[model samples]
Target: MAMDRLFAPPAERWQAVSPRLCSLRRALLTFWLGLLGLGGAIVAGVVGMWWLGAVIIVVAAAVYAFGWWLIGRNWRSWGYAERGDDLLVTHGVLFRTLVVVPYGRMQFVDVTAGPAERKFGIAKVQLHTATPATDAEIPGLTPDEAESLRDRLAALGEARAAGL
Candidate 1:
């Protein structure tokens, strides 16, 4: 599609995030929504409001259904690429974002994985620049991939910075 080209990778090779990210998101959504439904139902019962409980449960279920689908789409939307002098990260379905972090401007790179992300076998690579606006991150990468990217970016940043 015409819109796809607008956000395509510079080198025509966009590396997508792991699909396990989708699973992680869906699992979290299910847990939170389930808790909401259960907690609401219990509160409604204690207050003698069966109708309100039903409404809450129905709303939570609806949100969970929508969230489950949206999570997959969102995960699929994420991608990153290392170009000649910059790293490109793109994401979003309705409101697209493209972040270009130049090697020369990179201050440091951070690789992190929270418990849930680790459970899902995924990590995030965050690029810190001298300017906050240009800071970017690529999430849902495998640990090995995240480390490799961090090393490459750090080397590039050092090389470029030393030239200045």
Candidate 2:
């Protein structure tokens, strides 16, 4: 009956990821492409195609700008709620997806951070299950938060499995 409340995060539910994720994503993209742009410019200049090099740089900048636009929206799209029996993960902007992983179904939980993610002090939490199709992941949380979530999930998994 109340459609307005349907879209909202459930009461005391849905822990949001770090807002800095957008900047972290954009920075990672820029760092990777910026290096390529620099190399391309150098190579084109060596091959006597100064114009091509300039065009490459311009295109790189434009692409980065477009991708940066999506980073914010994509960052905002992620949410996770720990229900009594399962974890609900929702993400995506143009392509929405929802994953439900039962606590008893989780085989393990992994917390990871790549170079860029470590630099940004963010980590991703991956949930492993016997059924790969039921696995889920939650990204863009601080290292501490990620570890806490991992511990909680593992405990919940063990408790749920013991009951089963």
lDDT of each: 0.92, 0.88
Whole-structure CA lDDT of model 1: 0.92
**Alpha-carbon error at 126 in model 2, in Å?**
1.0
Q: How well does each candidate superpose onto the true structure, as a TM-score?
A: 0.95, 0.87
Candidate 1 lands at a TM-score of 0.95
- The sequence of per-residue lDDT tens digits that candidate 2 reaches over residues 29-116 is 8889899999999999999999999999999999888888889889988999888888888888787777889999999999988888
Error of 2 at 113 (Å): 1.9
> How far does residue 162 in candidate 1 sit from its true spot (Å)?
1.2
Runs in model 1 deviating more than 4 A are none
Which stretches of model 2 miss by more than 4 angstroms?
A: 1-12
